[model samples]
Target: MANFHVYAAGTGSDVQHPTIRRIGVSDVLDALRLGFEDFWDKPSHYVFLGLIYPIVGVVLITWTSGGNALQLIYPLMTGFALLGPIAAIGLYEISRRRELNLDTSWWHALEVRNSPAMPAIVVVGIMLMALFVVWIVTAHTLYARVYDDAVPLSIGAFVSDVLTTQRGWTLIILGNLIGLLFALIALSTTVVAFPLLLDRDIGAYAAIETSARAIMANPVPMLFWGLIVAVALLIGSLPLLVGLAIVLPVLGHATWHLYRKVIEPAPAPVPVKAARSRKRSN
Candidate 1:
């Protein structure tokens, strides 16, 4: 197992090697612009490729008749679970590699969705599912307890009823607090970890720790990035969840680039020589 370490910004640590570039808002925006340019450079290709999963996700969530929370959960998780970063990973790698004038095929990025990286992807998928479960259970549990007499129907009714009750308010506040904490922890690493694993062929633990170190070193920028993602997600939740079709893919590709920016790839190790050579005589 590879040893991983986290460091504060300006810590002068080996992991915080000079090769890793710290980024800011402008850097992120520039990357997005470049990604968009790459996407549009071959508009029909990306549109055809990108639209499949997101469209299905939007349709399922929009038409599902259930609690809004549950409705959102089923489709989003389904899309993520099936695709599991396979769709946009190639686009992301291509975009990054293009910057270096390296020619790459879309299949090259898709290839990361193979054996070794699969477990890391699964871990992330499970974490997302756990978060979703917490959200649904808490939201519905509070709704049930608070609105038993009223029998709230719509999402708006459930939210209104919950806000009006002490216990409900407590649950909402606590849930948000807990969610924020998890979000912070996740944001600190998820941006770089997955791509690092794919790009470096490193194990999940090393990738995660390296990602965490990158975030710790650049806390302010990472916080801003997290805020941007959160706001984008909230906005995407609007338009009856249709906006997610655009937002999710854009962010997914952008995150792959972000990982490339922060986590310096470890150098290939030199092999050790044998102490002595044996000779055979006949």
Candidate 2:
């Protein structure tokens, strides 16, 4: 993350006031580098949990196979990445512990289970799940709407239709537009909220508000960061999702660093002389 002081202005007299900051593209890249460093430092902590992603991927692929099922397959597999932020709760903890020079073992990493933020995190998790559910429903509706007369039951038939037909082209354009809407909402609300929840005792709504403010303050860099996340997760899912063992942890850790960059820490109180003069100074 960039120097905290640059963005650490006090929003109010309250100590816990969230201070949003603007960041550049370089800070985003730096966050990733730090994320990789954290991952390598404690590779063992993530290995077992990372293994689970592949198993989940395999299960999802198998469950969504066949002809008509093809349409759902792409969204279901990629859209699950929408939940990657919440799922990486453990990773954020690991990164936090590492940054503080605290214990970063399996026990400390999963400490989110007992965190004060658990209740709020649960609410946020449900919100993310809702977004994912909506995407799935929308995708299914789009597929059915596109192929009104008949259904394609095989992969080849499905592929041929989408590639060679005007209806397929329309579905592609419209489905992606709808999918993009869901993705942007997911990205804006949770990009920094999960990490903020893990770090503070604040409620979910507060964390989400702070995350939104952070993005709005740095719209350009946040947009670039969002694209990086979407592309990385998509690529990671391509190779039977075996790449997620490395990809998910890295992104999770990087998100913590990025959050640090965008959400300024509360500034120290003004000196006695300045405090008196600023009472009505807005």
Candidate 3:
């Protein structure tokens, strides 16, 4: 058997040690389906937390409509982006702990806010914001170049025009292609890396490398998992943003399960003297 140990943090003497266990593709799919069922069964919990989606959406729409909205919305956006992952960490922990028949709470999950994993959360938030900025800037630049108008084209117009143009088609295809690549990277690592950091007290780099190695070692299963996530996200985007609430939470929960499956901590080493002594005694 391939044995490994993962050093986890905040695990009190009373808590069990975190270990990496072998997992399979069927396990990943089951976890995803279970997470969705859990969400559906307890819609109230998500509904309360998910209100932020629509509220943020409204604020963003208002901001786009030419209000001095940044004053109010920018901070909200940043906070939402930063805190969203932190919040998801708790859900992840809860799901795992629940599976183990351990006690867990929203408060416990919230503790991830102060954990070392925060850096990874913050980095992801920054990347998301950067992507949003790039998309906005590209749309505006294209509009300016195409229409020869100084005023920024509305997001709706930009999207519509791009969808209709050859350039737009190219951009769309290219964007999906790039997205697929990143999704593979993300699928391989993000699930295991973030929670592993929280549980292991390890740095993000080590967690990421460990995750990558796990992916490399199990390419077929990881590829299948990545494709599943990509397809789900694509479907989610079809309904505009509403699909995000369900898709995002389900993905978040499913990802926690995937992490559990892919990462197997190295096993503790047996002492050579103990082995020789045992053989002699036998």
Candidate that would win on lDDT = 2
Ranking by TM-score: 2, 1, 3
RMSD to true structure for each model, in Å: 7.7, 6.5, 7.7
lDDT of 2: 0.81
lDDT by candidate, in order shown: 0.57, 0.81, 0.57
Put down candidate 1 lDDT per residue, 1-282, tens digits, no spaces.
122322211223333232456777776776566556666555554555566655766655555445445423422432233233444565666666666777654554565566355565556545655755565555455445544534446766556655687865765676566557656756665567666655654455555567677787778777777777777766765675556556655766677766666666567654443222222221
lDDT of 2 by residue, 38-155 (tens): 9899787786667667678778878878434777877888688888887789989988888888888876767789886677788889999999998999888888878873655787
Which residue segments of model 2 deviate by more than 4 Å?
A: 1-17, 66-68, 266-282
Q: Is candidate 1 or candidate 2 better by TM-score?
A: 2
Clashes of each: 0, 2, 9
Each model's TM-score?
0.67, 0.86, 0.65
Model 3 clashing residue pairs (backbone): 3-267, 4-265, 4-266, 4-267, 5-265, 5-266, 8-199, 8-200, 90-109
lDDT tens readout by residue for model 3, 1-282: 111123322333222324445567888788798778656745656555555564565557576558532222322332233233434666676666667777654454566676655665555445545655554454444444554543435555666765798765765565445444544545555546666765655544556566777777667777777667656645654564466567666766776767767666546758999989999999
Best by TM-score: 2
